[model samples]
Target: MVFFNLWSVLQWYLRPFIKWFLRKTTRLCELQRICYGDKPGAERSRNVEKSLMLSRTRDVKQVVSYLDNTVLERSFVPRNFPEILNPSVAIILRAKKINPKLHELFIVSFRRCLAQIWSYRLLLEEVEEMRKTHYDSSLPEHEEKLLKLWSLLVPNEDLESRVTKQWQYIGFQGDDPKTDFRGMGLLGLENLLFFASEYPQASSHVLSHSHHPKYGYTYAVVGINLTSMAYYLLKDGSAKTYMFNARQYLPNMNLFHKFYCYLFYEFDKMWIESKPENMMEFSIIFKKFENAIRNELADPASVFRINIEVDTI
Candidate 1:
């Protein structure tokens, strides 16, 4: 601990001098070094985010604040990218004493990183808002979505009544599934619906696994539990590596849903493979599972993809 503490203090003091020396020798600012040295995606984007946040220059710092303000201002519209980020990039270039005409690629790539970083922030707010909204039985839209989920997962059987025990067929705690969504809210429902809709066969396969008598578990209930896990991964920024490295180029609601699907699908697999004594072992296994995911996310190159083949309807 003492050795690490001393190293931290020493690095804090020498960081600026080291950056200055590197800049003098390479004739490149720290941002340029990261932007040019690293390949596109999470590693470059993550490093640029750190460099901007730690920068001493006011204009460089404004680049960070400007992107943030734009996100809060609801300016994540794709058409607004150049308008919102270009000025900030120009300001940063001037502050760093870089010739705009010479390093056009750096300006372009830096702007992309700014977009990726702030868009993820905006997406976090959007997801948290969705998670905070409690499921409402009286709301028609909410009711409709609930019904849609049932229809997607259990296609053959029709729900007899709104408050019937049929919900247990798909693994609700009681007659109604609304209360089960308390912690994750509608986000839980969204994740399940997306999985059933987008990758029907995969979800069906997992749903079938949930019914293994010796390995049986509540499907919808366990999905909500996985939803909580997905929220934590996003809330703490562990999802950034996967999000930024994704081919989507922007983190959005559907991407979040896909993330939740990945977790639910994978957790089902883990539960079966672990072959636990019973449901009492869920909490311990889930914690171990989450730790494994965190380790994977710590790698900047990590891009999570499930091996399931999407079955066509």
Candidate 2:
């Protein structure tokens, strides 16, 4: 027994050798040294480098422009406010003027995007609560305090599960929200992952291709550039008031869509104005906007949209 124990200890001591050998085998050290500086920062820098590379792999120009034009630009729109531009009644009024099928798709996509954004707002609230918990301990209880504070630092596994499984199929038991969602009667996970992966190379690939059951949905922040810009502009602006006015018109607007429409309108207006009279300047603005959406606001669309089928259920 003693000999066996000693041998185990010796093997344990040599475990470091095994790790070093594996890292060497993987070319990790050389890769890290080349990708990051030679210091503790190497790991941190490597992680960030990987993250940035993943973020940039997408052709996100259009996405970013939409974000910037709607969310970031200062002069024209309400910052942080939802842009309500559905014009459903207007759409109905002009149904003959526009392609009904295209309009229907737009409405469906827009509503789904809005629902996803609503979830985002809840996410933001959780984030803010977490931030508050970190900075302020004035909450009534320690549990509440811990929850709010640590929320920002940690991922909300519970919330992730809730949103992911909200509209799951009747008998579906898979864990991943993206793959498990039975709505749209999607044909397995391949196409869905392909569609979303376009905006983020690494994440899109993982969400679309990863085989792990638990590693279901990638929480990609899809509309953040616009959201960030909207918040910035609406910071003490008239968007809140304007949105309230628009809401009077949308009795059927879900809370998610209500705020979303307001936000969308804000950006659409801002982008239209900022669109340069000259083609070159317009192109530059468009490019910057795309980067912001593709890189900065890496939101997952699978979780964002409201499942119309679920609304009735």
Candidate No. with top TM-score: 1
Candidate 2 has a TM-score of 0.19
State TM-scores per candidate: 0.95, 0.19
| CA deviation > 4 Å runs, candidate 2 | 1-97, 101-103, 118-122, 135-138, 143-313
Worst lDDT 10-window in candidate 2: 298-307
Candidate 1 Cα outliers beyond 4 Å, as residue runs: 1-6, 308-313
* Residue-wise C-alpha lDDT for candidate 2, range 1-313, written one tens digit per residue: 9999999899767755764685568643322332333222213223323322333223223332344344233311222333432442233214223344544543443333332322333333432332233222233453243233223222333334423442222112433333332321111222223222222332223223222243222222222233334333233221222222232232121322333333333333334456444434534654565454334223211112222332232
Instruction: List, residue by residue over 1-313, the lDDT tens digit for candidate 1.
Output: 9999999999888999999999999999999999999988889999998888888887777677777887788887679987877787778888999998999999888888888888899998888889999999989999999999899889999999999999987889999999899989989898888988988888888888888989889999998988888888899888998889985568888888888888877888788999989999989888988988889999998888767463431
Candidate RMSDs in Å, in order, are: 1.7, 27.0
Ten-residue region with minimum lDDT total, candidate 1: 304-313
